[model samples]
Target: MTPLAWLAIGLLVLVLLAIGLGAWRLRALSHRVGSFECGARRAGAAGAPWVAGIAHYGVGRIDWWRLWSVSIRPARTWSRYDLVIAGREPFVGDGPDTYLVRCRYHGQDFELTMSRAAYEGLASWLEAAPPGRRNVVV
Candidate 1:
């Protein structure tokens, strides 16, 4: 084979190695992304806090009994959270019974809705988070 052809093969190998390494790093990082709950199918509220890069949207306070969230794009909200939002866009429900919440974050808008059951679980996890933990995305 020509010297040039060998060089090309070496370059390809390097590129593949880089991509594989990068993916492994990302997976490791996500594993430590932090989940509040143990993710068990329990009778009462018990769920994990959905992690996002946007720190501005997160739980403000977490107590044993209640949680307060300053959600910019709350997929669901609970009275316990004291969820602070501006407007409700449309009637796009998650389903026949569930309601959807469309809100903006970081100059962009997105919508998400959850069932009454899911919301309860989320609230539980958020409230259970220890104190002094700020809701940060990153």
Candidate 2:
């Protein structure tokens, strides 16, 4: 084969590998222990859904991983102690079947939108806090 042909084949293989890896990661993340689709808006980026990611709950923290990124590392991690739900409201314009809950985390001052079920689970987790911690606003 020509040198150009070899280079082209190499590029094609890389593309296929990337696609396969991305698909595998997305599927794996969806089925992972505590993952949920959540939209995030930076404190400075209100009125815009700047990021969409998955939130995975750990023992005492929730890790946010970007939906389209290939990295296994979380983009942001929030500790339960530091998280205080400023408020929650029904998210608008997402869809009917799956209702989204828009909430603001006090410490980060950022907004996150996730499914109703996910929100409920978060609320339960917050409410189950041990004694001595201040109340969480949900």
Candidate 3:
């Protein structure tokens, strides 16, 4: 076979491998309780502070993936132990059904916005600390 033909075949194999790996990663990360449409932002955004993504809640962490990203790794993970629900308010232009929660994780403030159901689940998870321990949410 010509060298060009071999090169094409190698490229095809690499593309297939990438696709398979991406699929596997997405499946593995998505096999959880549920994923909710959410948005996040660092404490210091200028005009508005919302970046869209889907949040997957795991045992002790919440993994956030960007809405358009296909990467397996989470864009951000908020650990339960280091998370504090600072406050909550309705999602201004997003309608009353959607809400936003201000959280402090590892000393950095962030804002997460999600639907009522997702928020309830998050609150439950945060407050579900061990019997003797307590987590405050508002």
Candidate 4:
């Protein structure tokens, strides 16, 4: 084989190894951070698309990261005090076990689609807020 061909093969191997390492890192982060998969979109925006993401239940806040993104920072964060659950319904086209939760944060509306278990966990987290800090609509 030519020298150039050998170099190309080496580069391909490096790319594959980088991809594998990234995947492993993501999996490890999810497990350690206790993140859950969810979809979100702005409720009043026209032509808005649902974005799949991972949600981490943090102290007094929920941190959301785009699922397919390479960045380590959260794309959005909602505080427990600012978020109010307006209603919930079954999310069509996903599955029977999935649910759509409508919520308001500082008067702005948004929707979250997640599995039944995740919804329950979210509800519990909101309801568990400390005394004198509980204003959630649930």
TM-score of each: 0.34, 0.87, 0.73, 0.80
User: For model 2, what is the alpha-carbon lDDT of residue 57?
Assistant: 88
- Report the Cα lDDT for candidate 2: 0.77
Cα lDDT tens digits for candidate 2, 1-138:
999999999999999999899888888888997888887876656556668888888988888988888897888888777787777776667764344443445545777778788887777887787876534665
Q: Quick one: RMSD of model 1?
A: 13.1
Candidate with best TM-score: 2
lDDT of 4 by residue, 26-50 (tens): 6755785557888999996647899
Candidate 2 has its poorest 10 consecutive residues by lDDT at 96-105
Ranking by lDDT: 4, 3, 2, 1
Worst 10 residues of 4 by lDDT: 25-34
Model 4 TM-score, 2 decimals: 0.80
Which candidate comes out best when scored by lDDT?
4
Estimate the overall C-alpha local distance difference test score of candidate 1.
0.36
| Candidate 4: regions farther than 4 A off | 1-18
- List, residue by residue over 1-138, the lDDT tens digit for candidate 3: 999999999999998888787676656655656777888887656477578788888778888987655676889987877788888888888888898788898788878888888898888888897764445569
Rank order (by TM-score, best first)? 2, 4, 3, 1
List of clashing residue pairs for candidate 1: 53-137, 54-137, 55-136, 55-137
Indicate the residue-level lDDT of 83 in model 3. Answer: 81
